[model samples]
Target: MASTHILSAYDEELKYLNRRISEMGGLAEQMCGDAVRALVNSDTALAQKIISDDVILDHAEREIQDKAIVTIAKRQPMAADLREIIGTLRIAADLERVGDLGKNTAKRVIAVQGTGVPRKLARGLEHLSELALVQLKDVLDVFASRSAEKAEIIRARDEEIDAMYTSLFRELLTYMMEDPRNITSCTHLLFCAKNIERIGDHATNIAETIYYIKTGAQLEGERPKDDTANTVGAPAE
Candidate 1:
């Protein structure tokens, strides 16, 4: 009877950990969406809100870490169960990073405020962010479902996000070169684009974590990445 009771308590703790991860994931996704919306609309208030909310993500990560450690010490989970706890830790870390990247993007909105970037460039960023946000949401779903197949599919699709970033990189460069006045705004947008791309990379990392938890094996053969642009120039005034 004692053994059965201990097993039930362990299961309950795992459930609590899963809920925490889901909460963090939801906040990160919302922050990413809000960051892009703030950028497109030049909504400084919204951007500030996103930045402030990053602290919540930070606290969530710390909470998950504390809980995971305690659960390990108390439950002494092994094999797949241990992997689940470890995977939750890894996912929380990635989600926190996603929050940071989104915060960075939101800050750029303030930096380039009143610069009035071209609509086409803003649309380009919106498109890129759209893809990244979808990837993040889907990968979180994969984690919750614990489907290695879905996780692998999301991992394979990260190259598309990278390709979008590369294209935006070129477009922003052209905008700056064509009009020196566009340099400041385009440069800010460039950094924001890179942040969104990085968020996609984090989503891919989460997918790999899910894959590992499910299969106890990392996806081999070089996780796909497509950004190859290497030009860095001073921010235009």
Candidate 2:
């Protein structure tokens, strides 16, 4: 009876971790979406909200870390149980970074406010963010489903986000070169685009973690990356 009670308690703890992770994932998704919308529309109020809400993700990450550590000390989990706990830690870190990226993009809204983003550039950013958000949402679903196959699919599709970012990077550069006045706004947009691109990278990292948790093996081969912005003399700013 004692053994059974201990097992039940462990299960409950794991479930709590899963629930917290899902909550974090949902908030990260919302922040990423809202950040982009705020940027395109120059909504300082919404941007400020995103910036403030990032603390929630930060707190959740620390909570998950504390809980995982305590659970490991108490439960002495092994094999699959250990993998699950470790995976939760990894995913939580990635999700926190995603929230940070969203906050960074939100911060750029103030810099570009009143400058008016070009309609074409706005559309490009929208498209890039849409792809990144879809990847993030799908990867979070993979975490819930524990579907390694689906995780693999999500991992492979990260190249698509990279390709889109490269295209947008080129377009932004062309706009800057065409007019000296466009440099400041376009530079801010460049950083925002980089942030969205990095969000996709984090999603891919979560997908890989899901795969590891399910399979107990690291993924084979280097992650496929197609982001060529650096080679094209992309600014570090």
Candidate 3:
């Protein structure tokens, strides 16, 4: 009947959106890596690459949004179908913000284009990048499978990222205070830490949005904070 055909089309749309989302994730993840590498090595070439590559992420985000809009307009979706469409759109917005955060980090890397990073600071970035990427990858899994439990798990990783960010923030602050000469380099590293933290946040935002689409529950104070991060991928409060 009409419902069956509608579902078939909906499934096709979800598949396409999922592919685009994964592509966005891949690009954002690479951008984060390139941004980090650019910071450690002061490689302007890599920084420039990340800046340029952001276009692909932006395009993917727009395409996903357009598809979601069209799907909503064309189909009189049932409750579950409507949730899936809304959820995917929300997730796409989060991925786009992820792209923005990566680009911002790259811009900061470009600013300190020739500065040498401290060894201690370099070591911290290694850990931060790993944690951030893991959170991002988990959200993609959540989207594909619609697993609320896995979404909750992304929040746990966000906590780990927060702790790492706080520790790194204090350490860098102390280093800058002790040696004014370290200020420029420390500031660049601070942006890297902050960008990584924000990436974790966007992933968290996607989790909460998807959870709400599924359950209609706002996961404590997750609502207001999500509104801020989804717009620009800025650090969550």
Candidate 4:
């Protein structure tokens, strides 16, 4: 009876960990959406909200980290149990970075405010953001369901986001060359685009974490990386 009782409590702890991760994922997704909306619409108010909400994500990450460590020390979980906890930690880290990148993009909106950037260029960013958000949402679903196959699909599609970023990079360069006055605003948009691209990369990272959690084995072969990003100023901005 005592052993059963301990098992039940451990299960409850795992459930709580899952709940925390879900909340964090939801917030990360919203932050990115708001950041992009701010960029395309020039909504500084929404951008401010995204920046403030990033603090909430940071706190949530620390909370999850604390809970994960406590679960490890008290439960001493092994095998799949241990993998789930570690995987939660890894996903939380990526989600926090997602929040940070989104917040940075929001800040860019303020940087380029009143510059009269081209609507076509802004729309390009909006389209790229849409693709990234879909990837993030899908990967979060994979994490929740522990679906390795779905995770693999998400990993394979990361190259699509990189391709979108490279195309935007070239377009932005052309715009800047057409008008020297476009340099400042285009540069800001370049950083913003790079930030969204990075969020896509984090989604891919989460997919890998999910795969490892479900399989207990590292993914084989080199991850299908898009070398086009190397020419995107490499999506590291």
Residue-wise lDDT of candidate 1 within 1-237, one digit each (tens)? 999999999999999989988899889989998998899898999999999999999999999999999999988888999999999999999999999998999999877788865788888888988999999999988887999999999999989988989889999999899989889888889899999999889999999899999999998879887867554354656
lDDT of 2 by residue, 1-237 (tens): 999999999999999999999999999999999999999999999999999999999999999999999999999999998999999999999999999999999999999997989999999999999999999999998999999999999999999999999999999999999999999989999999999999999999999999999999987888999968878885667
Task: Give Cα-based local distance difference scores for all models.
Answer: 0.90, 0.95, 0.79, 0.90
- The list of candidate 2 runs beyond 4 A from truth reads 233-237
Candidate 1 global Cα RMSD: 3.4
Tell me the tens digit of each residue's lDDT in model 3 across 14-114: 78888888888888888887788877788878888888888888888788888888887887677877777787778877887887887887788766666
Per-residue lDDT for 168-218 in model 4, tens only? 988999999999989998999989999999988999899999999999987
Candidate topping lDDT: 2
C-alpha TM-scores of all predictions: 0.95, 0.96, 0.87, 0.95
Model 1 weakest 10-residue run by lDDT: 228-237
**Residue 164 lDDT in candidate 3:** 76
Deviating ranges (above 4 Å) for candidate 1: 231-237
Residue 31 in candidate 3 has what lDDT? 87
Q: Count clashes in each candidate, considering only residues at least 3 apart in sequence or on different chains.
A: 0, 0, 0, 0
